[model samples]
Target: MGLTFSANLGFLWQELPLPDAIRAAHRAGFAAVECHWPYDVPAQQVAAALSGTGLRMLGLNTRRGGPGENGLSALPARGAEARAAVDEAIAYADAIDAGAIHVMAGFATGQEAEAAFIDTLRYACAATTRTILIEPLNSYDAPGYFLTTTAQAEGIIAKVAAPNLRLMFDCYHVQLMEGDVTHKLERLLPIIGHIQFASVPDRGAPDHGELNYPHIFAVAERLGWPLPLGAEYKPGGPTEPTLGWLLR
Candidate 1:
């Protein structure tokens, strides 16, 4: 079966406006698009762009708490702020018809932080019907981030116990933090809400990565994973030139 791709506009076409980025993804043969944050752009314009391009907006991240704060949900002292961010993400997602919202867990640790995250997730899940995602960022790239492993994320999901709450499994991070990507994918398939990928180490296009995306994709296909796996990578230059990997 032909695999579908979702261009992550946050990394691709960074030079263009949000609306223009959506159009670019459509023109580039991406089945859909996802983003880091779209709050700066008006929801109406973003909605219109998605409507015009006929591309599904896959998922988006909640607002980072403040400067140096990667996320807010796990901050024990920032309960109000975390919930506010969740509300904002839900509103924006609803307007643009995004499929999921990735709740960022800021720099934190311990039982208190876990409790805070679970509480915040409960609020987020009840507030919207859209799927809620929590990603385990690599400790190397995201040092001190609350979540760092798939097992940790799975445990949190079990604790939160919200059907809408699932994991955002990014291949690059998983490969960096832990190896054996294919086996982990099969094991964690039940709780994975979204899948994203980039080249390992440098976070570049997947074509030249240490990991073989084609084989990984084949394993994913056999697992009956959903369509449009996310292409979230830094292009280094203009995104158009880096898209050769998409056709491979």
Candidate 2:
């Protein structure tokens, strides 16, 4: 099969709510769907939509507090809150049958951040059977973001040593922070739980990106990655019209 694309409802279908977006993705030919955060909508509602449409829920992020908060996993002072967030994420994942949870590491630095991250991972592993993912966000987009590179994520995953803890390789961020994506994908495939893509610099659809998604897709296919490359990009226009790239 070709590289299957999962619709990221967080960026797409801005006009519609979660249920409508889930249906829209099904109608748009996406086999799976992922979102930034779906905490507002009840998990049962999202699950019902997925169940009705037969579209799998790929992943979702833990609640990162509110407007000011990016993440809690790495915050040294928020250990209790971080564990609670993990529990909440697992609850939603259980309801939706989501494949994984992207455990966001908030803006942090120094040994405390690492210690908290390790603690959070250990807590998550014992808490749920679902995959626990950590992604490296580019500093340009998420300035001072605790996890900023594959190497840093790798080290945390190593120290945590949880069987379910895995990496979330976002191509857009990776390309910005470290350009050798194909090599990194090949090397990190074992630990990469999910793969997401958006245009480098613009964070738009893959067609307009500096990176050649087709070639990258081929590399992912060759490496035997799980299906559905997550399309975590903003549509320049409507969610549907911008999807012509998927047909190609």
Candidate 3:
């Protein structure tokens, strides 16, 4: 079977409840789709869009906060707030029938932040059956972001030791932070529950950039990863023109 692909709604935020987008993805032959926080659209609307289009809901990002809000990861010191956020995210995921929730760690610095993140993760894992993914954002893209390295993420996962917690391996961030993609994937594949990608340097369609995606996909196939691969990139224009290569 081909790789299960998920269209990331962040890149197509202008068009939503995204019925047309889902139809387009289905016409192009994708099995699933994902989105960032869809707080603007009612959960029922999102569910309706999926039902009509025959597209499976892969995942969605959980909310952090408004402009001034530091975000859940930054609030690790506030266990009660973190727990509330995790609970809210899990409830949303359960509502949408989404298989995973990508928990974003906002920019928070210091050892205290680390302690809070670990503690919150343990609580989240215990509370939800759906997988929770912690993604490492690129420092350049998100300066002051708390989690930015595979090693750091692995360390947190090790400490949490929950089967429900896993890393959201974004190739774009990893490529920017550390260039050795294949080697790192080999090392972290077992712990990775989900994957996302964008072209390096520009965060566009996969084929437009330096990373060799076919080879990467081949490696993933070899590893027998059963999860969906997230198409979390900006389209050069319409998504189809940029993603034509994947259709072949």
Scored by lDDT, the top model is 1
Over the stretch 147-171, how does candidate 2's per-residue lDDT look in tens digits?
9999999988999999999999999
Q: Tell me the whole-model lDDT of each prediction, alpha carbons only.
A: 0.94, 0.90, 0.80
The number of residue pairs in model 1 that clash at the backbone is 1
Which parts of model 3 have CA positions greater than 4 angstroms off?
68-70
What are the RMSD figures for all models against the true structure?
A: 0.8, 1.0, 1.8
Rank ordering of all candidates by lDDT, starting from the highest: 1, 2, 3
Pairs clashing within candidate 2: none
Q: Candidate 1 on 188-235: residue-level lDDT in tens?
A: 999999999999989999988689999999988999988689999999
Tell me how many clashing residue pairs each candidate has.
Answer: 1, 0, 0
Model 3 lDDT tens row, 1-248: 75777778778433545656666777777778887776666777777778888788787776776585436755655677777777777887787788888776677878888888888788878888888889998988788889999999999999889998998999999999988999999899889988999999899888868899999988888888787788888885666677765675
Best of the two (1, 2) by TM-score: 1
Candidate 1 deviant stretches above 4 angstroms: none
